[model samples]
Structure formats: C-alpha cells, structure tokens
Target: MCTRYRVGASGKKLAERYGAVEAACDAPGVEAFPKRRGWAVCAVKGELRLGTMGWGFPPPPNGRAPVVNVRNLASPFWRDALARPAQRCLVPVTEFCEWEGEAGRKRDRWFSVPSLEIFSFAGIWRQTAAGPVYAFLTCAPNALVAPVHPKAMPVILHPEDEARWLSGNIAEVLPLAAPFPSQLMALAE
Candidate 1:
C-alpha cells in the first residue's frame, strides 16, 4: 500500500524538476513514513507550489486506522477530495518499498522508475484539526511489483501527466489510476 517511500531530492531540486516554487517548508528526508511530514507539489491558482504535509489522514469517526493509501475513489469519504482540483497533489518519490518473503522473514523490496530519478504519485490532501494531511492513490500491481506486493501499488504519474492530474476533473484524471508500466521500473539493489 506504499506505507513507506523515499524522496532523495532537496527542496531546490524538487522545485526545479516540477517547475514549482518553494512554499512553507523544506523537502522531506530520503525516507518518509506514515504520520510523518512529507513534501507534496500542489497547484495554487496558476502556479505550482511545493510544501510539506503529514502523510496520513485522520482516523474516521468509527475509530478506524488513519488512511495512508486511497484505493476507492468512489467512496464518499474520498470522493470530495478526488473531484476537486485543489485537493489533488503530487507526491514526489524516488523509490517505494514493499515487504517481501514470509511473515517473519519479510524484507523490504524497493522499486523505482529507471527513466526518472524522481516521479510523482497521484495524491490528495485535506485539512484536519491536527494539520493538513495527504495520501496517494493505489491500483492493481504491475508485473514488476506484483511478485513483491500482489495487492496494490501506488498510482505513479508520468512527468507529462503531472499537471493534468492536478488540474483535470475527476473524469479526466481517473484514468490515471492505473499501474505504471513495468518496463520503465526497476528493483533497487
């Protein structure tokens, strides 16, 4: 479900790559974990802005767990954020990790897009009492990730589709909720 990921670039590098202006906080460290702060690229007015946000959404009223990955866009809980352009965001990531092997012998398997040092995951964000929180969408795993994590993988966006994911309507952006091509991705040694 992409509970852990890495963003190796600094704020300046992220801003340059995304053509965004640095906003409130510096970029996150190489590794990002749930409930911690991470960098996200958001569209403000006509400009792109890079800022920090917590990684998980607050727990719902039923006392469920905090949401770190969004899989059901049609759910009422996430529909509002998915339908609004302002709530959409880009989660800059260098690599993502999934646990492999048996229950006690699980090991982290890192994956990345070989063609791009940094890529964006289709994300959504909203403000809560604690602070602003963000979560990225997940889809069926691709060939590369299926063996390690058969359930799902983050919905990674190509550089050319970053802007579209931020500004496009639900109808236009929903199609991007598919797995990235396996040929473009590699396993980190």
Candidate 2:
C-alpha cells in the first residue's frame, strides 16, 4: 500500500525509530526509463549496499506482470526470496503517502514519524538483469494501516533480526513477517 516514501538517515526525519544506517537511499536518477524507487540494502551487482532500489524486480522470467511488490502471499519470488541469503531491506522515510475514504475516489494523506525522526519499512530485494529491483514485502494490515490502505504490512525488521535477516535462513527470517508496533506509527495530515 505504501508506494511513496521519504528516504533519509536523520533521526528527525524518520522519528528516531531507525537505529543503524550503513547507507542512505540513493536519490532517483534522471533517465528516460527510471527504475522503481525505495530504500533498500541488498547485494546489487554483487555488492551489499544500502540505497534506493527500483520497485519492480524486473521484467519477469515468465513474462509475468511487473513485480513491483514482494508479496509473501502471492509473489512468485516469495519462496525464492525467502530462501535467498539476506534479502532483507529497509525503507526510511519522513512521510509515507496513501489514499483513503472511498472505494472509487480517495484522498492522499502524508504519514510521518510521530515520536521519532525516521523509521524503516519492511522490504525485500532481488538482483535482476536490469539491476536490483525491490519488492516491499507485505503482510496482513494492522489496525493503523487498515483504515488508510488496507491490504498488507511491510516486513519490519527488529534490531535483533537485522543481523539474522541479513544472513539467516528463510525459516529463521520468517518470524519477522509482521507489522511494526502501532505506537511507533502515526498518520500524517
């Protein structure tokens, strides 16, 4: 549901929720065809660096629709992604935008860090022929996100899960498939 996000390392930006910052998001580049954009940490081009990644992983191998989301419930890459080493990534944003209120026409609201400066949204990534495309992982929506964009929650990683998510087995990382604490989330006007 969160397609737009603000990327930065400042505690003031993400609401002081994010702890470590190995790398900040790479600003979008100017190109005729731009890659999907979001904060990420993955082995792109054989390098594990934190930066903004394109939303869609790539033109699918099976000619599937654009893989913009790493949906655990439906993404074909779910099993593969979970099995892949350290597919975990994060999104640090000042505000996440979403539409709400109606079934046909909705209004967008800007959600920012309430008590902290910045926070990381749960995500996953995979290297593609074009580059490293990311699919922000999602689970069942919580009470907070339900009213706004009711579908799923990002794969928020706990501080303890960071190391393991970046190195542990699929079984080990599966437990992180939940929404972040509601206390840490706030809807932006």
Candidate 3:
C-alpha cells in the first residue's frame, strides 16, 4: 500500500485537471505523508471541489498510526464511509513510493506512469472528531509492484474514470477498483 506519494503540480493545475473549483485553502507541497494536509477532489452537493484534508483517519485508541490504505469496503470500520457516495474522493498523485528491504535498511522506489504524468487514486473521506480525514483504496499488486511489495497496491483510477468514480454508483466504481496496467507504469529511480 502507498503511505507516501508526490503531487508535484500546483493546486491550480489539480483543480483544472479535475474541473474542481479551487478552494482558498493551503495546499500541500510536492511530497505528502500520513497525517499531513494534502489536496483532495470531492463532489460537494454535486459540484466538484478541491481542498485540503488530513492524510489518514483518526488514530485508534491504542495510539497506533492512523489508518491510511483502505481495501476491504465491507469491513465494519469502512462500511459507513463507503456507503455514502458523498464521501468518495479522488487523490491526484504524480507518483507513489514503496519501501524495499529490511526495516532498518529499507530504501524507496517510486512508481508512476512511464511519462510521469499525474494520475489519481480512488479514495474515501469522512468527518472525525479531529477533523476531516481521507484514505486511498488499495488492491492486489500488479506485476510492476509485485517484486517490491507483493501484498497490495493502490487502486489507481484512470484519467477518464475520474468523473464516474466520484459520481457513479457502486457498480460503476467497483469494476475500476483494480490494479493499474503495468505497461503504462514503471518504477522510477
């Protein structure tokens, strides 16, 4: 799963790409991390709006790291948020990172389109006592990511599917929640 990602484009470009109205809020810089503020595109009252939201859901009572990558929509923890289409969001990412090797010796390798163009992750958000939080969905890894992290990869949405992801019903979005094609993506140094 992707715990870190890069969104290199300016807030204005992100808004333009998704046809969202820019909100007068502070946007995150090139690199984004868990618990940090970053931009997300969500439909509010049928209008696309771009704004900032914290990276993960509120931390569990045990004080472990907040939940970041969401996979099982049927899980009780995610059921309410997933049931509401209003909470669905699109997380624009230029690239995402995965760590390889032992914990102490782990190194980073980035993944993105071969051309390094912007892409998006299928996401969901919700209001919490702390504030609004968002998490990107993940699925089984594709060939490109299997060697590095065989468990899972983010549910990267195609550019053309952005609107449907935000507005479509469960059936329309379910078919799209799979690993991206390996041919269009590569590991960046």
Top candidate by lDDT: 1
Candidate topping TM-score: 1
Which residues of candidate 2, in runs, are more than 4 Å off? 8-26, 29-35, 43-48, 59-65, 73-76, 113-115
- State residue 33's C-alpha deviation in candidate 2, in Å: 13
TM-score on alpha carbons, each prediction:
0.97, 0.72, 0.94
lDDT of each: 0.93, 0.59, 0.87
* Model 1 lDDT at residue 163: 91
Please state the error at residue 126 of candidate 1 in Å: 0.4
Q: Which 10 consecutive residues of model 1 have the lowest summed lDDT?
A: 21-30
Model 2 residue 60 distance off true place after TM-score fit, in angstroms: 4.6
TM-score of 2: 0.72
Model 2: weakest 10-residue lDDT segment is 11-20
Flag the better candidate by TM-score, 1 or 2. Answer: 1
Show model 3 residue runs off by greater than 4 Å.
59-63
Q: Residue by residue across 1-189, what tens digits does model 2's lDDT show?
A: 555555545323332343333454545522202245655555434445555567766655776556655665445546776677666666554456667887777787666556645555556677767666676666776677777778865655555665566677777777777877766777765
Model 3 weakest lDDT span, ten residues long: 57-66
